[model samples]
Target chain A: MLNIIWPVFIIISFMYAIVTGRVNEVNNGIFEAVSDAVELSITFLGTICLWNGIMEIVKKTTLIQKLTKLLNPLVKVLFPDLKHSQKAKEEISMNMVANLLGLGNAATPLGLKAMKTMQEENCKKDTLSNAMAMFIVLNTASLQLIPTNVIAIRTSLNSANPTQIILPVWGATIIAAVVGVLATKLITKKIK
Target chain B: MVNYISAAAIPFIILGIIIYGLIEKNKVYDSFLEGAKEGIEIVFKMFPTLVGIFLAVGALRSSGVIELIVKIVEPMTKMLSIPSEIMPLALLRPISGSASMAVAVDIMKNYGVDTFVGLITSTIMGSTETTFYTIAIYTSAVGIKKTRGILVAALLADFAGMIASVIIWRIMSTSFC
Candidate 1:
């Protein structure tokens, strides 16, 4: 999907720039984007490292096990294929934990690990399983309890009530998540 | 208020994790270093993908494609009660995080940060994930070539988030007013 989408973006943008006579602007944007990507990755590096480190500690202490146990009922319902797979369950729960805390960068590795684990259990190599589809929906909808980054940005911009959007964000994300999961379940059921 | 509590949450989580690690008598420091090293490697692996998407998004925005998109979508957005000014952010939210952040920042700058449009943009930004980026990095990490059904589901979620943000903000703003 991305294979087609990524190139199409570049092609469309280039064509649009030429037609609009904004080639110079596109050139500058490309240069700035390169630097921006590097800077953005570096920023992610710091936060990812810190959160992963904390997660590592949590894992070593078996806190993840406890979390998995606590989340098992919900997780099992969402990912029935992972019902007996303790490792996948642990990784998925940890990923959900990171996501709920709004640690996206930290959640990615855990999510990737969970996906890889689930893939290993699947009979088919390339095709996604129903559980994997559900996981993707849940992760992407990502019902965040604390939108730390958004609030931080609003605060930096000097909003009088930076966190005023918190309740609305939570409400919207929950709705998105519920809708996503329902859609995934219905679609996967029909396909099966 | 909620802001103060949320702000303190991260530190509280860190402290709790550390305390639990100590109680469990784990080699917390060594484990942390190992995880941090792994995190760095993951960041490096994601760098090229980030560069490709960022440049495309940057060009798309700078070349006025996004603005053109906004113009085209203006009527639909108005009918949906979403401000036309935030159309670009809604469109970009599912594609790239930084790009959408830039749009949200721009909206907050042009409109007062506390205004209805600004609040909706912020809420939308917070609620939605970058679906394309997440799918790309995650599927590649797992070496999955065929991403069946996830894309549509994720995009649906993004759409839901966008509409919900606008609706939720409208209700909340009305109550406040």
Candidate 2:
């Protein structure tokens, strides 16, 4: 995955550059141009570690168990196969929570972990099962309540009312998120 | 690295491990070590994706392409009744924070940071993502096969937020700040 990530990034970047006439800059300072690859792990380490701890606590306390119990019936409609696993249910909810806070930085690994975890039981080996499709849909159409990271960036840059866009952002996230899950559920069901 | 974030997490983690060990009849420390080992692998996998996306954003700013986009978008920006002065930040706000920060600083240097333009640009900043960077990294990490609907919806969301920031600031300034 790491190997694939960079190659894909390079190709996308190269295409963007060529289209935007940034190819000239790349040729001139190839090293300088590629400077962003420098801190591949250090900064995200802090957030990842922090969120991982949060996730661990959430799982340990059975907040996840309770949460799964609550979301399960609704989830049964969207992800009928995942109707029962405490672990899978916890992972999905946490991943969704991270997205709600606009923690893309954190939500990502959790989402990936959930994907791998779901694959572990090997029950969905035959096809793109409801649970698998539901996860993909949820991750893509995550509902954000706070837009925390974006708000932080705005405030740091001196915006007068960083919270100004809160409502619209929330509205969009909710709509997309609900639509995303339901649409995927329906689409997958029809295909099956 | 794990020590700090795990500090508050220690109590829960220790409890979880102990419970697991007792249930499964294994050593608590052994279970914990296994968890830590798995955590490290997860972080390592995220590397090149984050690095490449951030770098590409840096390049966009340095190359002045972002500024050009801002200029092109300025008229539609004004039509929305948003201050045209914020056009740069409106465009940059979604792509990169540091770059947008510098641009905001430049706007502040010219407009005195407390003015409507500065305030609104900053507000817009607080409200958006580094769009391309997020799309690149997140979609890659999650692997979305089809992005058309997501792309259109996200951009519309961004546009809605951008407009909302301006209107809110305008109303807020006249009434509150």
Candidate 3:
């Protein structure tokens, strides 16, 4: 999907620029994009490293176990099929916790682990099961308590109140999660 | 008051993790270094993806596609009380995080960082995931060929988040003011 969409963006942009006589602007934009990516990545590195370090320390403790226990019931409700799979439960819990803390980079491995674990239980290895669909929806729309990346960008931009969007982000993500879960449930039932 | 508390929360979380690591008798500093090293690697890994997406997004914006989109969607946005300036960010957000981040930064640079458009763009960025990217990586990780309803559900969630960001920002801005 992205493979097609990405190239289309470039082509359309070139076409539009030529027609609009903004070819010079497009050339400049393309040239500037490389540095923009480098700068953004570097800016993200310090914060990513800091939070990831803290997460690593947290991982060495029994915090994950406690979090797993705390989130067990909700996980059970969301991933009912995984109720019997201890490994799946742990991976899912860890993924959710990382996501909620806005540790997206950390969450990817855990999410993949959860997906692989769920795949092991699926009768059809190639096709997505209902459980996998639910997991994807939840992971994609994961409710974040702190939008650390956004806050970091705001701070870097010298915004007076970098964390001011915290409440709005929390509210918005909660809505997304709810809507995502509900849609998953509805769609899965209809398909079955 | 809430801002102060939320701002303090990051430090509190760091302290909590360190104290927990101490009680657990873990080698906190070593583990931190290991994780930090992994963090650096992750940043490097994202470089190519970021560059590709940014180039595309940059072209799209500079070539007048964004303005074209804004013109087309301006009425609907105004009806919903969302500023048209943020329309491109909302559109590109689900597709690419780096692209959307660049747009958000552009918005902040043009409009004041404290402006409603800037705040809402930041909120939207925070609230939504990169849906297509997440779907692609996740489905491929498990070798799932058929995604079924995942795409629809994820896109719906992204839409809901976008709307919610605008609504929440509008309600909260009054309090902040």
Candidate 4:
């Protein structure tokens, strides 16, 4: 189904451009795109550097362990086949925690590490294990409660109530998380 | 007992991310640089494609091509009974995140950010990512030559999120009272 549609869509969008004579308009767009990415990448790199230090302090204090233990039961439900391991619980907990706080910057490394850990535990290379894929879907869905980016945009735009976005963000995240989990679970169960 | 356990780990969880990145600082820098470099490369790669598409769309928008399309789409609007207010999102959401953000922001400012409209806008923003940007970046980074089903899956999920946001916003705004 997708194999056919996506290529066609791309071709159509491209053809639309060529037909409209906008193909020549790309030099500026290219420069703009590269500049935007470079700027964003630098900021993200710095963010990870700073956030890593904070994560270390938390680890030394056993904060991560505690959170891992707390989320284990729900993790069990979400990844039913996952063995109850101290490590697995920690990775999933860490990923979910980073996401909840709206720190995708933090969540990603955790998500990647969790996948590696899951892959090692499950012993699969050709396909994603149930747990890893579930986590991926959830992380990508991004259960943001405070929505820092949106708030920042609002503030910069001179919004009267930047903080007012919190509840709506929460609603979106919670629903997306639930739907994402459910859909992933159904698909995983059916396929594998 | 459970809340107690996780709450305590908040500080440490953050710490781990920091230390992980730092301990592998070299790897992190290399990857970051690679992404930066690749980003530039991608700009060049996607430029020819993006500009052509953008100009066509821009002209469609500026030259009233879209307005005609909108008229064509008006019957569906009536059929679904969608508000005239959200018609722009139907057009704007797929192609340009910033444009939709502008539209959403305008709504928020005029109607009050605390209102239902504001909530819907924020919900939509939070729920769906910049789909094309994410897809292109992630797929290119992974070196997936053909991203087969992923694109459709992602956009479908985004569309679903948009619908859900509207419905949920409507419910929250009304049901609470």
Q: Write the per-residue lDDT of candidate 4 for residues B1-177, one digit (tens) a residue.
A: 323432344455445554665664434444444434533443344344334334333434433434555688778766764434455554455455555554554455445666666667766776666556544543343233433334444455565666677777666556667
Better of 2 and 4 by DockQ: 4
Q: How is the predicted docking of candidate 4 categorized under the CAPRI scheme?
A: incorrect
Question: Which has the better DockQ: candidate 1, or candidate 4?
Answer: 1
Off by over 4 Å in 4: A1-68, B1-60, B77-119, B130-157, B172-177
Q: Lowest summed lDDT over 10 consecutive residues: which window, candidate 2 chain A? A: A56-65
Compared with the true structure, all predictions reach lDDT values of 0.78, 0.54, 0.83, 0.54
In model 1 chain A, which range of ten residues has the least summed lDDT? A59-68
Instruction: Give me the runs in candidate 2 sitting further than 4 Å from their true place.
Output: A1-89, A100-104, A115-192, B1-75, B93-98, B101-114, B142-145
- Model 2 chain B lDDT-worst window of ten: B1-10
Q: Tally clashing residue pairs in candidate 1.
A: 0
lDDT of 2 by residue, A78-118 (tens): 55677557687677777766665444555778777776667
DockQ of 2: 0.10
How much is the lDDT of residue B128 in candidate 2? Answer: 54
* Candidate 3 lDDT over residue span A1-192, tens digit each: 558878998999999999989999999999888788788778778876776677778666777567767888898888887767989988989999878766676789999999999999999888888888998888778568777667767776678887788878889999999999999989988774
How high is the lDDT of residue A50 in model 4?
Answer: 40
Native contact fraction per model: 0.75, 0.08, 0.78, 0.11
Query: Between prediction 1 and prediction 4, which has the larger TM-score?
Result: 1
